[model samples]
Target: MIVRPRMHWLRMLFVWRGSVVPRILPRLGFFLALACLAVATGPHPFNLREGPLGLLGVALAIFLGFRNSTAYDRFWEARKLWGSLMIVSRSFMRQALTHPSPALSLEERREVTDLLRALAVSLNHQLRGTSVPLDALDSGVRERVVAAEHRPARVVLGLAEWVARLRHQGRLGEVLVTSFDDNLDRLSEVLGGCERIAGTPIPYVYSVMLHRTVYLYILLLPFALTGSLGWSTPLVSVFVAYTFIALDTVTAELEDPFGTEPNDLPLDAMTRAIERSVMDLAGEPLPPPLLPDKDFVLT
Candidate 1:
C-alpha cells in the first residue's frame, strides 16, 4: 500500500515501518544485553552453548520463512477475491444493458439504472462502514431500498423484484426473466464472497503464538550471537526483527481487503468504477475516474 518509485527499495522499507520489530526490539535488546552480561560476568560464560544456540537459530529461520509465506498467501487471496467482485459487477451491468426490455417505460428504465447506481454506492458504504443516507434518493425509492439492514442485498433483490414484475405484466418474456435471474445469482455470489472475507479472520491463536515466538527468538538471539558477533548483536538483531515485523504488518493490512487502510483494496474506487460503467451503458455521462493523489493509490 505504501507506494514508492520502482527503484526506491529503501523508501518502501521505511514506509512499511517493520511493524513488529520496531515495537518489540528495544525491550528485547535490553533483555538480551542483560542476559549477555549475566553470562559474560559469570565464571563459565563459554559453557556448552553452541548446540542450543545453533538449533534455535535454525528454528527461528524456518518459523519466519513459513510465517512470511502464509502472510503473502492471505494478501494474494484477498486481492483475487476483490478482482472477482470487479469482474462480476461488470458482467452484471453488461447483462442489464444487453437484455432486451422493449416494453419498459421511460420511467421504469430510469428507475432500473438508478437502482444499479444506488447498489454501487450502497455496497461501497457497507464495506467501508459509512452511512448511506435515505435522502440520497427520491423519497419513495429511498424508503423502499433503505428499509433493509443489508442495503446491497436489498438493492439486488429490488432488481429481481422488478424483473419479476415486468414478466408478470407481459413486459418481458420468460427467457429475459431467466437471463436476469442468472445475473442476479452471480451478483449474490459476489456479495457472499466479500462477506466471507470480511467476517472470517486469521486464527487468534496463530497470531498470539507468532508474536510470542518472534519475541522469544529475538530475546535469545543476542546471547547466542554475542560470543561470535561480539558488539554487533544489536545490528544483527535489528535485521532479524525487521524480517518478522515486516511480514506481520503485511499480513495484518491484507487480512481485511475492504478496510479503508492505505494498503487495502480500494473498494470505494471500485464501486465508483462500477457506477461509471453502468451509467455509460445506460447512455449517461460517465463520472471521472478516481485518481490517486501521490504515489499511493487508494488501495
Candidate 2:
C-alpha cells in the first residue's frame, strides 16, 4: 500500500508513513528509559543470568518468525482470492459476448455485467461489514439484492437466474450454461473465502502469548545488557526493541488484511478495477481508474 519513489539509505530509516515504527515508538522509548535507569542506578547485574536471557531470546525469535509466516500466508491467500474475482469476471465477459442467444437481449447482457461489478463491490462491503452500496447496482436489482441477507450471494443468484432464463428460452445450449455456471460457482467460492478470513481469526492464545513474551523480553533486555554496555545500553536497547516490536505490529496488521490500514489490501482500488474491466469488456465508455493518494496509499 505504501507506494513511493525509492529512497536513499537515511530516508528509509526515518520513513514513518507506512512503517509500523510510529505505533511501537512509545514502547521503544519506555525501554530506552529503563535501559538508562539500569545504567545510572549502578546496573544491578539484575543477577538475571545472561544465559537464560540469551536462550529465551533465541526461542522467542523462532516463535515470532513462525507467527509472521503464518500471518503472511493469510494475507497472500486473501490477495489471490481477489485476483480470482477479477479473472472470473473477465472470463464471463468472453463467454457472454460470444454466446449465441436471442433470449439474452442487450439490456439483459448489460444487467448481468452490472451484476458482476456489484458482486465485487458487495463482497468488499460485506467483508468490512459495511452497508452494501446500492449505488453500485441498478435501482431494481439493487432493491432486490439489498433486501437479501447476503448481498453478494443474491447478486450471483440473479446472474444464475439470468443464465437459466436464457437456457429455458432455447437461446443457450447446455454447454454455454455449464460454462457460465462454473464462473458463478467460483464467485461463490471466492466470497466464502473472504468470509472465512473475516469471520475466523488467528487463535487468540497465540497472540496473547506472543504479546506477553515480546514486552517481557524487551523490558528485561536493558537490565541484562546494562552491566557491560553501560550508558550505551539505551541506544542499543531501543534499536533491538524497535525491530521486535515493529515485526509484531506488522504481523498484527497483516493478520487482518481487509482492514483500511495502509498495509491492508487495496479493496477500494481492486473493486474499481473490476468495474472498469467489466465496462471495457462490454464496450462501454471506461471510467477513470483509481489512483493512489498524495501519501502514496491506495486504500
Candidate 3:
C-alpha cells in the first residue's frame, strides 16, 4: 500500500490520498444534513437523551476496536507468510545452485530458477484471483503450469519432481535431498497459510451488525445532542460520524489484504522482490524493484 514518507502532524491531518476520508465523506455529509434538520426542528417530538447514546457510543467503540484488531491480524499474518515465502525461496534457490552433483547444466539451472520465479507470480495471481502474467513464465514452464488448477501447487510439484530426479540419478544424496525437502515443505506451509487467510474472512454477521449500528448511531446522534448543542450540532455530529465510519471503511479494506485497494498489501511489489532475490542468487542481473505510484501506492 500507501508508502508515503512521514509528514508533520498538521500536514498528516490534511493528507487525503491514503486516508479513509474520501470513502466516508458522503456518509459524513448525510450525517451533517441530518444534524442540521434536527437543529431546525428543535428536537421537538423526538429528543434522544445523551445518557443512553453515550453508553451506546462506548460499546460501539469497543466493538469497532475488536473488529479492527481482527482485520489487522489477518493483514499482518498474510504479510508474514509472504515474508516466509521469500526466505524459503532464496534458500531453495541456493540449494539448487550449489548442492547437485555432476553440476546442473545451464538449461537445468534455468529450469529450476524459472520454477522458483513462477511460484511467487502464480501465488500472487492466485491470491488476488487474477491470471498469471505470461511474461513472468518461460514458454516451457508456462505450458506445464498454465493447465494446472492451482498454479502455485503445480509449480511446487515441479520443484519436488526435479529434486526426485536428482536423487534417482545419484546426483543428490539422501541428506541433501532431505534439506531440499524441508524447504519445500516450508514453501507449502506458506501457501497453505496464505490460502487460509484469503479463503476465510472475519464473519459477515459482525460486519453487518457494526455497519448498521454505526450508521444508526450517527443518525440518532444529532437528535440526542441538538437540544443542548443547538447551532453546533451539525459540526459536532459530522466529526463524530467521521471517526466511526472511517474506521469501518478501513477495516473493510484491511480485512481483504490481497485486494487492490490502496490500503491492501502490495502483492505485485512483493512478488517482484521475490523474483529479484532469486535472480540475484542465480548470478543474473537483478530486475529493478517495483516503485510505488505517484500516490505512493505500491500495487
TM for every model, in the order presented, reads 0.81, 0.96, 0.98
Best by TM-score: 3
Scanning candidate 2 in windows of ten residues, the lowest lDDT window is 100-109
Which digits, one per residue and each the tens of the lDDT, describe model 1 over residues 21-126? 5555666467656555744654435553546866876876677577667656766775666566566656656666566456445677567777777777787678
Better of 1 and 3 by TM-score: 3
Clashing pairs in 2: none
**Each model's lDDT:** 0.68, 0.86, 0.92
Superposed by TM-score, candidate 1 places the C-alpha of residue 35 at a distance from the truth, in angstroms, of 9.9
- Residue-wise lDDT of candidate 3 within 1-299, one digit each (tens)? 99988889999889999798888788778888888988998847864699999999999999999999999999999999999999999999989989998888988888888899999999999999998985756788998889899999999999999999999999999899999999999999999999999999999999999999999999888898988899998999988999899999999999999999999999999999999999888877787999999889999
* Cα RMSD (angstroms) for every candidate in the order listed: 3.7, 1.4, 1.0
User: Per-residue CA lDDT of candidate 2, range 110-153, in tens?
Assistant: 88788888888888998877877667567878887788888899
For model 3, what is the alpha-carbon lDDT of residue 72?
99
Give the higher-lDDT candidate: 2 or 3. 3
What global local distance difference test value does model 2 have? 0.86
